[model samples]
Target: MAANKAFRFFDLPPELRGAVFSQLLVSDESIILHDTTFFTLPSAGNWNFLNVFLVNMQMYQEASAIFYSMNRFTLNAHSHRLPVHLTSRGGFLSEEGKDARRRVRNLTLYLTRVGGEFERVIGPALSDMVLNGNLRELVMRLGPPSSLGASRPPERDMEQRPPFQALLRLLADPYLEKVKLLAWKAHLAIFCPFHLRINSSRTDTESVDNQGIAILRNSTGWVELDWRAMVDVYAPGQKIVRIGDRTY
Candidate 1:
């Protein structure tokens, strides 16, 4: 009888191995992180790719970069300590960390409140990413400002909205291609594009079809989002803002 030989995954060509890694890790859908737990909104299941990194030292080095680079991560600014989490793994201390941070292209930050001292809370995370990471796109979701015994400003006061102002500073970076400011009102959600001409005085509303999704356009760009449908899908029972004829 002839002896049987074992097959080794690393024996494969580098390109083939990279292709396999991409298939398992790359996802266009956003991966969400609320506090410590991580999940995906579009696809909810017990799915994780961390094990792929634990296979071996070499695989860990290669796969970790692929995972971070290929997927967009969504984190709640108020809940998660993002900078601490990113730097805790020790990868950020070495060349791998630099590569991983540079690969990070997109991020979405959910802000529960948007007023006084808000920048102190979320500024560090944004600063680290903007200065070091190769961030191309940013999405900001502004939830209802805190109403707990404190005097909160009116919803229409754009000048006082610190988060919005922070986003404007971020958008000033020429490398950043897109920045979306999504706000949730009493029973209506508003969408605005934060761009170079964001301060320009122009507001135009595109017509909505049978569905309650409206596309708002201005000189900067257009924001087309179905907040009602999104709430039903990602956040059920949450009071979604109605799509109204408002100019941004």
Candidate 2:
């Protein structure tokens, strides 16, 4: 009599079995129903795919772990109109935390004028994730403002640059180490005033960090920020606004 498929899967040397499964798992395409069923069926993949990789176990754990680490979400201001789309597709706020942990290691928030209150929704979302010690890398896109709805005043727009101030405050927690801000407009730019406090423990410092607006009068368009350099810009002890580099 032939060995059962499930028996065959477990029968292979444990190392060999894990390698084969990992090869089959890593792919550019999304996993399908049959693919899921193959690993899920009684005679096929382990029933603990969700937990073994997400929560408990260690040996075959990395095999399960890869699935969670690879989950990445890209948010655009255009789609910002339908925020539920992000919440559903990204699974950022899963009750189990494991689901969220599995997929939300890297977050890319795309900016378009269409996504209402991009800061309101994305800011708090990222902050919550940071507080939970789950977020890894945060990437911000500075694209044209969302035009799908009413427009904001020019002054409000200046204030809305990158939530660098809020982000620095949150990053004081220390677990989070990397933050990148990508700018899309020549005139619109964000810079943390030098002398940003590392730990906002003092209450009566009486000196609120200056919120200086950077005005760039060029048209190079959107450019991704340098992570290392950004840290210096936000580091405590630097001045509010100072001339550094110009491409014009």
Candidate 3:
């Protein structure tokens, strides 16, 4: 049985094709799956983006699962449209696109410096993913903190983007503020991923260790996280945002 002279890409064995996808697409550092960065390709220093999956349907079918399942994704505190990007209809509203969202395994969320008056539906948007996305890892990155004026306008990449309709109902609900236990927390509380890490940083080297949002960062710093114990990493696996890179 001789090989066909007209060997196309499909002729390659499934494993070989997957190797190609991983080689071309996977990132050693976590990928940023945040607002604006999702549709448009942001400059991420040679890391692969979803555009590579646009080759065609068959290629998408073969390569996407590998991409989602193998690599870690970072969702910032401001990524309100997470459901659209992850478990909802997606930016394209395609079945395959939604399926891709459901396949993500390792995820990181930046939850430390939420300085605004309102919190984005970051947790609720990801409810479906945590429940049924076949996710295997969940990493949450918390403080060093930020001051009131720290956040900027949305166009400046500082303000949070809008939330998708997938979780619209939960957006304005006061249950979170009133009850003190977040709606999304219910989903997260039940999640048991294969791997979970929580990394935090701080600076307590000065007399004024913490002042409202203005927490000091110095050579002396330590962290203690007890609000919620769950899996982690971030730009939301953030900047791998080092959780160590910032001050708490």
Highest lDDT: which candidate? 1
Candidate-wise lDDT, in order? 0.53, 0.44, 0.43
Candidate 1 — worst ten consecutive residues by lDDT sum? 186-195
Which residue ranges in model 3 land beyond 4 Å of their true spot? 1-6, 35-51, 78-100, 113-120, 144-248
Which residue segments of model 1 deviate by more than 4 Å? 1-4, 34-48, 78-103, 144-151, 154-164, 185-248
Better of 2 and 3 by lDDT: 2
Task: Output the number of the TM-score-best candidate.
Answer: 1
Judged by whole-model lDDT over C-alpha atoms, candidate 1 comes out at: 0.53
- The digit string of per-residue lDDT tens for model 1 on 77-189 reads 54323345433444332233444455567888765554443455355455556677766777876553442113233366543356545544553444556666565432122
Error of 3 at 220 (Å): 6.5
In model 1, pairs of residues that clash are 187-241, 188-241, 188-242, 189-241
The candidate 3 region of ten consecutive residues with least summed lDDT is: 178-187
Model 2, range 72-168, lDDT digits (tens) per residue? 4454444435344344533343233334443445556665531335445555666777666466766666544343123332344443245544444
**C-alpha TM-scores of all predictions:** 0.55, 0.49, 0.49
lDDT of 3 by residue, 1-248 (tens): 36766557988889999898888667777876633226322334555456667778998877778877777777655332324543344431234354555677777665433333123345444454555565545655443233123433223222223332222222222222211112121111112121122323532322211222222233223232222222121012111122224577
